[model samples]
Target: MSEGSTGASVVPATVHLPDDRYIPVRTEDLVAALAREHDAFGELAPRLAHVGEALTRIVSAESGAFSRRIERAYAPFNPDRETVTVGDVGGDRAELAAILAYTFDKANYDLLEDTQVRAAIDSANVHGMKVRVDREKVEELQIFVRGRTQETRLVRTIRRPIVGEMREVELYRRLAVVFRMQNSVEVNIKLFRDIPVADLEALLPHAEAGMSNLDRIKILGGGIGAIGGATWKAAALLVSGTVIAGQYFWALIAGLVGLSVRSVLGYRRAKHLRSSQRTHHLYYQNIANNAGVLDLLVTSIGHEELKETLLAYALLLARGERIDGADALSRAVEAWIARRFHVTLDFDVADALESLDRLGLWADRATMRPLEPEPACARLEQHWRERTTEDYHARTLSQRG
Candidate 1:
């Protein structure tokens, strides 16, 4: 695809957008989705131990600076608050340790702040966060973070015809800010609007990526208050607070907003825990299934070393230790092909993974494996959890608008 040129720097710094077709972001709707994200991680949110252990295991061997940073700086801010949910990870001990993180991208003007975010990335790289991409849109050039999967794609389109990357980051942060309001469909439709010229300068000055961790939560607390004022009042009245039975109905509004906020927070916490439980269940089952598969096909691995690798894969799967092993599994395959095909297979991890990905082995962060349900006779409740809460919320939002 040919890119639009901008004088000396050929990076197509700007993309044309039609004036009339743009959608103004309805702060409420985006807020609702953002709220949903927070609610999804509630009480039983993935424990700090899970991610910490993974980092200690995966990243410790790679970077001394990162290891020191985690111990000295990050560990103090663990978000899970030490809650080891009774059965969040099903029957498997490994899934119990699955690391869950809340990520926020930022651009830092201050060297110290930049260091902090870099430290988080360093930490993630070492400990093993999921494989993620920060790409601009191939289409409208709008931004989005596509996750809830193995491969997370975080798009950071600046949306401004003018302004540098840092400015775009603030806009992105506001985009995240406007996102923290009440759930509404009309709000999502507003994303099509052109980024307002007024809000552009204020939002994009010092933006970067960050972790929405409980420890670092203060970072978001300051911004979440960017929450729309009038709407929050209305919601509080409807959810839990007392509404007037008569008169100006001012009391009614108050009651509803107060009630709604409480109900919303409560519902969100429950929803988050439920989702984590589902994640744990799925990760747990994969471990069990892999182990079972290895048990039956132990000899099929062909060589003892490969057999050991398969066993390690099974263990990591069982443990929910998502260290990317596709690159290595690939090298082994190349050695195998060279022996068989007599064609010298170059050391190309990408191609090996591509071939494996086609055969359902290499995962682009999303598991290529089909989610096979257990046979009815061997089914276990510990192997599953309900995610119906999101459906219910979706329905409520649909009806409300």
Candidate 2:
């Protein structure tokens, strides 16, 4: 029952994924691409559409169930909830965290370890600001990121303190964080988009931003210049001897006091500017919060599940003889995506197989072959019928009781 420990169902480390688990193509687009590559897919296009629809329904059902589980677990900590519940708050909080971790995994997000978070803060980011997170104030913290892509960004150079455009800048397309404060047991959920990997520390709730080394140097140099100017003016006044002794003394005092005030004001202005920059960066990145975060996560889970299922089945049908096992199928899918969409990713073959197996489309487990498109569509329709019938009976029984 640690921070990220979910008892027997611990989430696996996804650090091996080069990009992310997300398939960067739409279902329809994927089908179209497959048809263009394989003539058989063009002939079975209608059946493939049917299979896609059926798989979507199944994934949607699973997503809805998981969403309910998350909402129930999160009820106690939901800040926007109107009702106050009287139960074991601690137990509810742990359950919420566990469900959220699972949801993040299902959504194909990679959990950021403490070490990784620290490393990101230690590294330089596009924004020239030093960020520090107060770990002592945090009772629990979990960060999950997904859709990592290399992008171009303007970053401050270390050698000359000049900004330049850097290519292949890694960034997380989506970021989700769960945080609980030491003083309060209530959990906080936050979701953001387009977070630079090096600036991940800035997303923390208790993160404090300070002026970078370059900014500090500028402030220090300005203060030194002000002092030098004040000293020169004082020396000039005394050397000229045009004013009386009391007048010269007051002039020196005024010059020193004004310099001190100017230095303080300059420091404050620089600090405020750094803080404003951090705020502006985050303002555009934040996407959702609290219950809204759960909704987005659930939706994402459904989308990822559907995409994986479609790709796996399509690959199996198109190249069933070539695929020897799950690994081979994964490679085939990955290669196809790289060739077609120009994106490389680590496909979650296990999850895809599980979905196909559940839908009864997986014909041979040993060979990793799926049923033909026409038969697969029929089987999925039958499965959907059974599911709907079971739901109808369950609802009927509940209403009667």
Candidate number achieving the greatest TM-score relative to the actual structure: 2
lDDT score at residue 305, model 1, on the 0-100 scale: 18
Reference-based lDDT, residue 112, model 2: 77
* Sliding window of 10 residues with minimal summed lDDT for model 1: 100-109
lDDT of each: 0.26, 0.72
In model 2, residue pairs whose N, Cα or C atoms come closer than 3 Å (at least 3 residues apart or on different chains), thus clashing, are none
- Which regions of candidate 1 deviate over 4 angstroms? 1-253, 256-297, 300-401
Q: How many Å off is the CA of 294 in candidate 2?
A: 1.7
lDDT for residue 339 in candidate 1, whole number 0-100: 48
Q: What does candidate 2's lDDT look like per residue over 103-180, in tens digits? A: 788778888777776655555333667777788999888888888776765544543346433434566788888888
TM-scores, all models, native as reference: 0.20, 0.84
Q: Which run of 10 residues does model 2 get worst, by summed lDDT?
A: 1-10
RMSD of each: 25.8, 7.6
lDDT of 1 by residue, 1-401 (tens): 01221111111123221111111122233223222333333432233223222212221222222223222222222222254444332232121111101011101001113332233222221001121223221111112111110112222222421332221111111121111112211111011112221122111212222222331344334334433454465465556645442322465456556655755565456445544443442232222121222221122111221222222222223322333465544444444334433433223343323322322322233542311112211121211122212132123223544
Quote the lDDT for 183 in model 1: 28
